[model samples]
Target chain A: MTTLTREFTKGLWDEIPLFRIVLGLCPALAVTTTMENGLGMGVAATFVLVCSNGLISLLRNVIPSEVRVACYIVIIAAFVVAVEMLMKAYFFSLSESLGIFIPLIVVNCIILGRAEAFARKNGVLASLADGLGMGLGFTLALTVLATLRELLGAGTLGLVFGERVLLAQPFGFFQQAPGAFVALGILLGLMNVLSKSGK
Target chain B: MKSYLQMVLSLSLIAVLSGLALGGLNELTFEQIQINILKFKKIPAVADIYEILTGELSSEERMAVEEGLLSEKRYVDLGLNEPSLFFVVRKDGAPFAVALEDYGQGFAGNLGVMVGFEIETGNLVGIGITTMSETPGVGTRVKEKAFVTQFMGMSKDAVLKVKKDGGEVDALSGATVSSRAVAQAMDNARAFYTEHREAILDAVNETPGGSS
Candidate 1:
């Protein structure tokens, strides 16, 4: 449906979770250390987002208005727990590396924000499209930041998952905390530039 | 009125479903999680120290050295189980040394340190830091590979003091508290070894077969 397409496409640019809406930042900053970690976290978050959004929308008519927030939280927390457990079982090393961040997903504002703002008012099918769009948008933002950081910091790209595509031989500072700030600042600046030019 | 009751009932049902789904997943994955935690905990301090001593340890030696690192039990025998540390000494797949990790109340909190000695020679083989939560860029310098490397081959009589105190070890810059903590931890390890020298030697003689 045209309505479904609009809802989904809006999340990709106009209502982007990180650059535009500016939600779900804790994991954004913490897990953007490596491209693999960023992608892993993004996908995990997306899975929760899509599931919670669809489920919440389906139950929107049933959930009492007074207790909607609590209901949404319970729904989001359940998805987070499921993701955390799955990661631990299959991707033990990554699960350990991500550490406390996985549990912290329960508190990520993006899932709850969509549930309340969009899913509560929208039909289940439309809500699913929005969830998918926002989730992809979040993943894209995280991946871009992480790629910039990892390439600059470690002097190598794709070093995650035993792959290497060298960009620069050595950029040691990129691997440090200060480098994280620098990369993020540049990305934000570039996003602003692109948006202004488009407008 | 009927619609309100239906809404409440539906929300309750959704909550129950979510709970059951998550509980079932957790139950399924609990064993794998436990195994991962156990492996993480068992990674021995000796392996880390050996890598420094030999520079790039063979995987087999690494495993052997880890096996040699006694678990917390040996410290229990010394009544030091309150906060115990264990070290295993290995020579060609046989454990010939036992090191104990100890923590001394330092400037910020507990300082984690390891001391290793050759059972036959009573010669201190190595000392290292495993973990510490001192002030970053300051107290953390104590755990620097350079700072810890100083403990190699030092005899029991070698006073483990910062150079400012007229001893052999250099105190970490701006982290005298952490430095002192390491020195004290070493001293405690020394005292424990001296008191239990016979048992330690006996355990070392048992070598590869001994329970670490």
Candidate 2:
């Protein structure tokens, strides 16, 4: 149980997916145009991470050593396809909004990375805990970045559910490509500063 | 001999298991995937045109239009589904004019747009964006209702240039490429309408002509 706690907490900050490890960047940049998309992507990725990790851990001993990587890929791909199909059926608008990014989650390094580094070695319980923690960490990071971008770019927050808080006149540049880079850069800098300050 | 046999048996077993898992999942999701595809084909623009032209399209016509949207053969011939764009065109009740749209490749990704034009007069009745994937705050200004609304009633031959080029259109403040891409897509739709006017009209004029 103590180990489980450690595994989950580590992903939140100490080994943050986007800031510390910088995994799964394609969707990070592509679908994060709006706060809603960012949140949706984060949740979807988290679901894939938890399910794949748990399944992989269960089959760790069963999978042959020689073809473990291939097996892991198939498992991850299956989960991605499942998620994509489900999203399309139930959340058509979001599925459409996220577009190709949902299918592209198969290529996201974070899922494969966790499967290789943790799930393949850990027990089922430990792997589940790790998956949940890391997935949440990734989601949190994406949400922060997305919120900053959306708030500055559109001059509104919570545009997804139509809960808009008009903070200030939108700074148009914040919504451009350069804005994405700037936002990410400042976030990285801030994270580093906070970490160094022992917070 | 024993070790070699063990290796072969294990490999085959794994293969069989993996195959069964994947095949089962595929079978289960096949129907859902088909449904999603059908739903995608019935996006608002296509539905609107189909409704206007035929009062209410039967499920069969809808299925036809859905198939048409998914079919590569016709889209490739019309250049409507380029790597840069995906388009759908439908005629109104008179069958003399058709509304066409192109989803052009913008700076970041795709931009979906719709335009209605008269096949006979070559006049554009309306133009609007159904979707876009441009930079926020900057490129997304193209999606603004005001910006899209301006393209209404413009003549097909009217030079749809940005005001920077001494044309009537106003470019998005920080999204020149995206703005230009939208304009160019409209131009392509106009050219496509002109080039295929007679055939499109005839197709619309035929019984069961409307999109589903």
Candidate 3:
């Protein structure tokens, strides 16, 4: 139980993805234009990570080392397709907004990284806890980035906060591709400073 | 040899299981996904046609119109089992025009357009872009009023191609491909409306608020 707790808590800060591990910057940069988009993408990815991690851990013993990557990819793809279909069916608006990124989750390094580095050697419960923690941490990082971008880029807080505009003249630069890098870079610097202070 | 066989067997088994699960899920969600596309994509385009025909709709009015249109779904039989659905737009409580969806090969994929035709004269009421994967701010400008409004009140017999192709329509400055695609969809609408004029008329007449 302590092991499980340790595995879970590490993802929250110590090994938090994007900010710390830096596994999925592609989506982290692309979908963080709005808080709603970021949250939606994070939740979708989390679903895939948890499912794939648990499944991979369960089959870890049976899967031959030679064919494990192929097996993991197939499992991950199946869950991604399931997420795509479910999102389209129920969360149609969000599905439209997230667009191609949902399917692209199949190739996200974060899910594959956890499967290869952690889940394969771990127990199923521990893998699940690790996946949950990593997923939530990713969600947190994406939401914070998106809030900064949306607040400055579009001047609105998005659907969660009734899309109220907080800026008199929001800088449009923060909404574009280069802005994602700038915001991420600044946040990463802040994270490093805080971590060093804690140490 | 035994190890090789185990690898082959396990990989095949995983693939088969994943295939079965995804196939089942696809079957379950196919219908709902189609409905969602119609609601979110097709209906809003129809509402755009409504806005053009009458006037700008306030948010409340647009919502009410969309709700009414959803409940007023009508279909024209095109030898398909499910039949093709179309929306009728009313002006002054009378069925003034009918809107149907058609598609053209766009730069990225199929570009869907909801085309409105005047019922009395068969002239075009206007067009609305339904679904597009064109480049944002470039090719996507084909959906803008400046581009689409050119089709409004055009005669059915007029050639529906961009000026580069010897037609009257002017293409967007930097997005000739997407502009041509919208023209292609307009041409398709003309052909479809001509081919199924009788059936479409009958369907509209049968509608509760439609006229003979």
Q: Best candidate, lDDT-wise?
A: 3
Considering just chain B, what TM-score does every model have? 0.67, 0.61, 0.84
TM-score top scorer: 3
Ordered from best to worst lDDT, the candidate numbers read 3, 1, 2
lDDT of 1 by residue, B1-212 (tens): 88778668767876899889888998999887755543344344556666655677788887765554434224324455442335555566656667776677787667767788777777777776755666545787886677877787788688877788878878878888889889988888888788878765554443232322
Give the Å shift of residue A24 in candidate 2: 3.5
What TM-score applies to chain A of candidate 1?
A: 0.93
Candidate 2, A1-199: lDDT as tens digits:
7988999899998998999898888888767767888889999999999999998999888776776787777778778877887787677788888999999998899999999999999999999989999999988988888888888777667655465566667776766667777888889899899899995
Clashing pairs in 3: none
lDDT of 3 by residue, B111-131 (tens): 988999999999999999998
For model 3 chain B, give the 10-residue run with minimal summed lDDT: B203-212
Candidate 1 C-alpha lDDT tens digits along A1-199: 8988999988889888887877887888877877888888888899999999999999887788877898898889888889999988888767766778898888889988899899999999999999999999999998888887777666445645455556547575665567666777777788899999999
Each model's RMSD to truth, in Å? 5.5, 6.4, 3.9
Q: What class would a CAPRI assessor give candidate 3's docking?
A: medium
TM-score of each: 0.71, 0.72, 0.85
